[model samples]
Target: MTSSLQRAAFAGTYDDESLCGSGLMVVRAEAEAVAALAGRIDAYFAAACKLILACNGRVVVTGMGKSGHIGGKIAATLASTGTPAFFVHPGEASHGDFGMITAQDVVLALSNSGETPEILAILHLIKRLDVPLISMTGNPKSTLARQSQVHIDTSVREEACPLGLAPTSSTTATLAMGDALSVALLEARGFTREDFAFAHPGGSLGRRLLTRIQDIMHTGPEIPSVPETALVRDAVLEMTAKKLGMTAVVDGRYRVLGIFTDGDLRRLFEKAGDIHTTPINEVMTRFCTRVSPELLAAESVRIMEEKRISALLVVDDDNRLIGALNMHDLLRAGVV
Candidate 1:
């Protein structure tokens, strides 16, 4: 019931000594090309890195067709990793997007053939605008390379496509080269995890990497708390008022002396005793786990999970109570 085209497509992916071997061969060749470029990461690489690092504006990357798509991706990678960058289609550059480029910016152009017409037509304009040019191309002697202030040779041995026309290995090499440039810039600038967090503030990684305990901890009146001399009823009231299912028992200076939780309440209610007059000191968990405000919220999550507790009291170095946080707080902060 299979059609000829579908059968042919499926058959290309079968067997060990077939076109699949050729496919892997092409990939291996491209990987070798990228590895060879590692030795060329010298003055030209340094100059390109310096150009982008010294940029007071942004990195405007441009290309045409498949190269343009790769350029867009490279621009995004650079931007997310602390180097400010964006992409402009070369075809669109003639349609007025070129206004986005400024004298303070650097232009990173990409082309596999190194002779993309739309890209070449703008070489003089880039020079006139005084924007430094860095090109990634397969041919070192191509027009883009000759016109570039810095040329990164990303040549490939062959196309993975059997037709030898569709870009495959060449694009992979170009992307890897872009990654090399981005990581080099990231290190030379001494960009930190905190800096990366700012760029990715909306994701789970952002929450874990950027947020501190103080930023998400429950404090002030929201912290469920009771005095050491307080009765069980009072502890219950504090827990209810804060809706955190627990309360920290403090001494005169608000130092965390013990903690009473809903589970403790359950145990008390189930015991053969009158709850009305029992002091929380008799029923509170004195050996409660505590954390510091400077600790990462993710670390708190680990501690809470390890101890099997739903809440924790945050204290200062002096053991004085500072704040409180619960599983709900972690969930709300997106740390969970």
Candidate 2:
């Protein structure tokens, strides 16, 4: 019974367009709200930052429902970025998690309405413990905000949800503000990638930045190398024995001068004369890629990829061949 135009309008306008429009509107409105409030940081925000910075223990973030979800994420961001923080459920706080909070700890409480009954119940206990309280609420004059040592306004003009009822824009604004705070504190404290590696030592970045080159390269017997004056036959034997697809050609002192690979063998095989009698120096590539022992194995992998090579010679400051790595080595080490 519906006209095609009506169906098209409904499909194109309210269905497909609505999603992006509403999401963008929510983010734009939230960004504006945060920018407006940034000018109002005043004494309250300063007090909150000061209290948190002075605390000897962790920041205990707590809230109920959607606010609780945001609080947990904020706590994680803060902790990963150099601030010691964790989230406690408001319901659980009243049960036993309240004991987790110490006098030296700071409380970062969230409640959009500033009237989460469970959080309100813990205000007195928090005060009694002399722990500084930082409240994030929409209502500045509400019980939780008024009772706190510092308050951040997370008020939203309206919900981005058309029904005017969901915690869409409000929660987004709170999360953005939380991220801003955590990143600011992280930069102020000079938190580095190495510091982050300690907390996330199982992930890709932890493995890449935290792992040393010595842990992954092929050394000792597995290293493929030949003396500079060695016959091409002997160098090919070393490469085949080590199974690295290439062999480092070094002088008597073990100073690496070049490398010989399968590519060189293929090129030499077509020669009109005796190739086995040829010296490795005659067929070796003099300007081959090399890396230092102290360099990251991941970086060495990148060099190999960029140079379109299958193997790299690891050398010391004096260019002495000490190790070697190939694509297979990188794959096995998880550095690829």
Candidate 3:
């Protein structure tokens, strides 16, 4: 940050330290809790991963209270990261949601205390179905852990809550553990960006990765172009009509020969070239940058920014002009 911005940002902090100390302590405790989890990535963690990977069905995550909330987020992360998973509240599981779990699926249950009655109520049914069980709990000797095929200990030294009654450090540690598992499984499955984009196709990130040049490029009459024999004025009229700030100088076969952009026009005018009489081929840039219609829209953005150009011409394998697009097209498509 600039010095002035730094001063403005810290202007009130010198006097508020007393009021902020409590929040600082809470953050520190949670940070320590997350830090301590690095050591717990042991054989038990591997066992859980193996069990989930071997399952042919989705992972069913269940928990009570705060753990349930954590489980829901964990399931979402897992689902988006390549693992097929869903959260089923323990309280709901005992009622009728137990039907969600199947013999082909793996059960990932969360209970900080290792003994949530609702979770315990369905324990017998899980075993009867012969489904593999993975439990994450603070107590290794708890009923949930004792029966689980694999147990992951997510214990924190203490709660961040000063009263030691609220779930804070424990929940943070659980979330970190969930993220660790999610990313590990993501890498193990060889998940690619396209795979991630397929799961998330509603946002800018999805548009950037999934959108292709063909999807947004202007085709047919929308492309700005003029034959090499045309005057600079003709190219200017074409560029203005297409509103792409540039025009392609093509041959009689509609093959791209060069590009005439706003920058080229400015340079030509500096040299006192006549826009109405000068041949476009003489002033246009030769061997202009071209892109494949199948290329990712995000990659096109990278190319445009690197080359410091606003427009790109698309061509076929035979070098025929197929489409055109500019930075504005990308912006409107949300690929920028």
| Tens-digit lDDT string for candidate 3 (1-336) | 479888887774555776599889999999999999999999999989988888899999999999999999999999999999999988887778899888899999998999999899999999999999999999999999999999999999999998998999999999999999999899989999889989999877789889999999999999999998999999999999999999999999999999999999999999999998899989999979999999998999999999999999999998899999999999999987
Residue 155, model 2: lDDT of: 86
Each model's Cα RMSD: 3.4, 4.5, 6.7
Query: Using TM-score as the measure, which candidate wins?
Result: 3
Q: After superposition, how far is residue 293 of candidate 1 from its true place, in Å?
A: 4.2
Model 1 alpha-carbon drift over 4 Å, by segment: 1-26, 237-243, 251-255, 262-273, 287-294, 302-308, 315-322
| Candidates' C-alpha lDDT | 0.90, 0.86, 0.93
Over 4 Å off in model 3, which ranges? 1-15, 203-205
Candidate 3 residue pairs in backbone clash: none
Rank all candidate structures by their lDDT, best first, as comma-separated numbers.
3, 1, 2
Ranking of all predicted structures according to TM-score, beginning with the best and ending with the worst:
3, 1, 2
Which sections of candidate 2 miss by over 4 Å?
1-36, 251-257, 273-275, 286-289, 301-308, 317-319, 331-336
Lowest-lDDT window of 10 residues in candidate 1? 11-20
TM-score of each: 0.85, 0.84, 0.90
Clashes of 3: 0
Span of 10 residues, lowest total lDDT, candidate 2 = 33-42
Worst lDDT 10-window in candidate 3: 10-19
* Tens-digit per-residue lDDT, 1-336, candidate 1: 999999899876666787568868777767776777777788888889999999999999998999999999999999999999999999889888888999999999999989999998888889999899999999999999999999988887777677889898889888988999999999998989888889999989889987789999888878888898899989988898999889999999999899999899999878865567999999999999989888989999999889999999999998998899899999989988
**Candidate 2's residue-wise lDDT over 149-211, tens digit each?**
889888887767677788877788788778877887787788999898887888777777876
